[model samples]
Target: MIQMIKKLLVIFLALAITSCKTQKATESKDSSQPNVLVFYVDDLRAELGCYGSETAITPNIDKLASDGVMFNKAYTQQAICAPSRMSTLTGLRPETLGVYSIFTPLRKVHKDVVSMPQLFNENGYKTVSIGKVYHHSSDDKKEWSVYYGKEANTYNDPKNIAIIEQLKKEGKNPKGPAFDSADVSDEAYKDGRAAKYAIETLEKLKDDKFLMFVGLSKPHLPFNAPKKYWDLYDKSKFKIPSRKKPEGVYRLSLTKWGELKGYHGIPKEGDLDDDLTRDLIHGYHASVSYIDAQIGKVMQTLEDLDLRKNTMIVFMSDHGYKIGEYGAWCKHSNMEIDTRVPLIISRETNYKKRKAGKTSDALVENVDIFSTLVDVCDLKFAPVSDGKSLIPVIDNPQQKWDEAAYSVYARGKKIMGVTTTDGNWRYTEWRNSNTHEILGAELYEHKNSLLSYENVSGKGNYKSVEQRMKKLLEIKFPSNGEPFLQNDK
Candidate 1:
């Protein structure tokens, strides 16, 4: 009887071993379904070495551009963190969600929304989010299989931390200086910690089909980075952008850049001095470089683990940032500077080794990211998204694409500004939110320039262009029924 029991145990153990090996092989052999590595940077504008930036030191990002299809005309649906990110993740427009504030809960607004990450999670991909994938760590709890959050405080300097703490204690506004360059390690900051977490997660997910989103919080607010990155540039060589608003732009089109003003050193009203402007610009460049270095580390890991060939990598910013552009300190308007963003997509041997290291001038928006990913992964049964797939453009950058990219801005829930651009002309129309009555309009010709310094909307020569844009806006966002109108796909 004892011998029979031992023999039965041996057989059972062998079966369990075989089952475990079979499961592991199945998980790792899903080569048809490529793993996805997304580097989602915050407040990163199109100012990298690949984007013809003259001064920004972004070697890692530039290399990614070299290995991928770079989109020169990528724009965000909305120029804020939460709304823009939500639009990309859900393939839904901001008007569809009607969420503009960072504090608003996403699930409350769209209960049944299938986010991009959630879809991947449901599709057997190990979806992981590190750092600030969403505006808040708690924003989309159900979307990620694993989430690693960073500390709220972005400052490493003890002085700045003290100032913020004291202000909070006294029932006062708590914000540190606009920029801080501290002599410390990269891990001393939030972006660095995020990079470390990403590297560790990548190693764990190498044997599994996974979707990892690593968010870097830098080049955003309170430009805080290590001293080494700040030392890369000389502040004197940094060119300060125009400090004046567009000549014919309405007062409603611009904000006081209250976001910048909330910092300790920035003034509540009035123009900043040349020294301060240069310092702020310097800090921004440093933060960008810091992020680039971290990206290099993560990319190196992807290569070391032999996962680069099978991973579809995407590098993008949530939205653009305005550093002294048009005297603007932040992104809250429909200005071209605030709307255009940096986007790059790269994969090796995936989808039959399509074109690489190419640049696409085709107009694209944040919503299209979801559509493109779905198409690349061949997720046919996934819920239909609001965006048109950019695979046509990615496969062929010069192909005839969408007419124009659309973006919108809400002014205190009272006024709504809708804008569009067709690579040649940009137009904006402000309207009463509730009544949908057009209040004002501004147009800029971008044939020779991208600066919105002059509004030649009603100019005799551009009358036809202005009229065309108006019609397009109506087609894009109709005044009847649901405001969540989609692009004619």
Candidate 2:
């Protein structure tokens, strides 16, 4: 009986060993696949050192760009937060999803739409969302296996908040010049905490397949940053942009410049004065530096874990911001300043093949991010993407590109503007939503000249250019209620 029991024990142990070996083999195969790490920022424009910004103190981002494909002319589908994010995550345009403003949630429009993270999740990836991946916190709940939450908030010292409140009692909005340079630890801000949590998550998921997305919220509003970063830039050296509302443009194409007005010390009624503009620009630069530090934290963790070779890092902003450009303060226009953003795709292959640090002047859109990742990770399942895959350009920086980018911004049934960029030119038309009447049209030449500073649409010298671009615009963005556009295909 004892000998029989021993033989049975040996058989059981053999079975257990076989099972363990099978599981280990599977894990080893899965681990060989490249991981995706996305660093999505809010309101970051094409102003990094990699993009030729002499003023930005972005070392980590510059390094990432050095080891990645830096897109020189990347634009967003929409300049606003919700619409841009919707188009980016769903791989569809805002018009197709009916997401034009921040009022609507993505699920309310397309509840089961496969998001970028959701696609990865379905493909056996342990998807993670660190912060503000979508504009609304709970819009796409099914996408993430680990949702770190959009725990983004504007935090200020109690003394500042109290002063603002006291001023509010006197009918003053009490914005402290639209900025704060508090002498505090990086942990005092939400972005710092985001980086910390992201680093910890990287350590936890080091052995597994992960799509770890870390969203950094900074340089958005009130331009809050730690004093250490604020000290990086000298306020006296700040230069106000050459203020020029695109000439020959329709009057309706101009906005009332409303974003920064909510601040306590901001002018309640007009564009910022020279002094205020200088200070605001300085604040924005400080905020950029602050966010750069947080990025360095997670990237260092990634490198320390020796995960660089088996990981792909994507760094991008939802849309670009107008930092006093065209005297515009925020991102709500069809101008290049608002539409053009920074996009860097860093693959381990680029580093290994000695083909990294290449810049592509290819006109790319934010929506293309979905397809690009799908192609990179070889994801089995994916939603039909409105944007095209950028892997071709990634493989060869000198490849021929579309030289085109499209964007739109609409305000209710009152007015809507659809913009199209071809090569060095941008053409935008504002139309009355109720009657489909043209309110205004603008055309700006960007090659070897001031970008968007002058509108040549009304000039006879560019009549043919305008006519051709108008035709391209109509073809790219068809009339509403028509077959949805899939031009990238």
Candidate 3:
């Protein structure tokens, strides 16, 4: 009887251990799954006070950065709006996907390519987008489970149409209103409406499990905002960037690239006089502050709805924009200000309780966003993805990652360009599409020349450094006999 009792006890112990293991595995999987909210901004640079900028007042964004892991050297795979957005959504390099310009829609690339929202939706997450998540207004409807706002901005409102007609009569720039703080109304602006709609949806879907995309369109073009926001910044307090032009800097004309001239309007070199420059800076700052206020509203709503503890918030821009940096006022350039954007990720409290107010200098790219979201949500993903999950970095900020960030721009079928950065060295090369002729080359060492005013591409001092960077670029990009040579002409 004692021997029989011993055998039964041993068997019961074994079964208990197996059951415990199964329960632990199930809990681990559940802990990894978290709701995601991507707060995407348009044409925003790393100019916030949190990212070492002293002037711009972005309180809400700064708060988000302080409470999460801030990526100090994050880059967009492309500088343009459409290509950059497409790259982030698809987790593929712009060059590899053959989407190097804004004219082409994402549908043209791969009809069945899984986007971030689509992937999440397939994995049992309710995906929805508010405002301008995608490039065009028309494409947003098809990409999201729900879309808010008009298909496109009413550019031809009777008041604006009259202004355009008058400008045409005078042979002046017929774009829109010049830089004016008090002239615009928030209701007329698309961004304000976007914010309103996003808040409403957040309130309506307070209890639903969702992956919500909140897109903010501000500080992009027209630089339009309420006068109150403009009043927040003193014009005299603004200072222009001190970066100088390189000796052989080749300014690629906008027409050649088939892109917009400037983010707002092409103000001539002398058009933005001292007063105008200060006003422009004020307008830009006001727009940022205005956006920050709107973000605050949304954040407050989330907290009030008791969803903050469960939702994972990610705040980032499609790509950076230049506000008088390098004598430029828009994106589409290969400069650091145009390519490097602000990336902040705020995980829910249940995810291992990361150190609050910590910053990570990890070199990350926009493509990583897709895999990060997937891993955070414990969702299944395809084996072949160009981006790696940022889970390791989020859990341990000091994690090591051996990789470089790359961005590409294609003006035409015959014109293609590429940019790569390894946290310190930045290299840009442009080539003709048909003849494969080298058009332009730019190289800058961030440690030595943070502003990138000094081009050390062919200089004797950096010969070895340039060679090493070139090899890394080739290994990553792998040009197929398309003449990957550098040209400074």
Compute each candidate's TM-score over C-alphas: 0.90, 0.88, 0.84
Better of 2 and 3 by TM-score: 2
Among these predictions, the greatest TM-score belongs to 1
Q: Is candidate 2 or candidate 3 better by lDDT?
A: 2
How far in Å is the alpha carbon of 421 misplaced in model 2?
Answer: 0.8
Off by over 4 Å in 3: 1-32, 149-174, 183-188, 250-271, 381-383, 432-440, 448-450, 479-489
RMSD of 2: 7.8
lDDT per residue for candidate 3 within 1-489, as digits (tens), equals 999999999999999987775565455344535677888998888888888888999899888888888888889887888878877888877765666666677776577788887776555556778777888665566766677734343342456567767888998767665443444556556666777777788777666667888888777766677777878777888887653565556555122221234323444343345666676678778888878888888888888888888889999999987666665567777767678899989888666766557787788989988888777777654435688898788777777775677776665566666678888998876767545466876778786433667778888998888877777677765545554322211
| Top candidate by lDDT | 1
Model 2 vs. true fold: TM: 0.88
Residue by residue across 1-489, what tens digits does model 1's lDDT show? 999999999999999987775565455446478888899989998889999989999999999998889998999998888888988888988887788666666776677788888777656678888888888666656678878864564777788888788889999888778887889999988999999999999888888888888889898888999999999999999888888788889679888899999989797888888999999999999999999999999999999999998888999998888888888788888888778899999875546757788999899998998988888776533777779888888888889888899998888777788899997778888877776777888998776545768888888888888999878777776655244322211
Angstrom error at residue 70, model 1: 0.5
Q: Cα-based RMSD of the predictions, in order?
A: 7.6, 7.8, 8.8
Query: Candidate 1: RMSD over Cα atoms?
Result: 7.6
Instruction: Give a tens-digit lDDT track for model 2, residues 1-489.
Output: 999999999999999987775665455347556898999999998888777787999999998999888888888998889889988888998867866878777887576788887777666688898878888876756678887887645546676777777887887655544777778888787888889899889999888888888888887887888889989988889888877776676665656767688766777775778998988889889889888999898988988998877888899999988878776778887877788889998887534443588998898889998998888777764668899898888888878898578998885546778899875888888876555466778988877532566778878999999998888888766545343322210
Scored by lDDT, model 3 comes in at 0.72
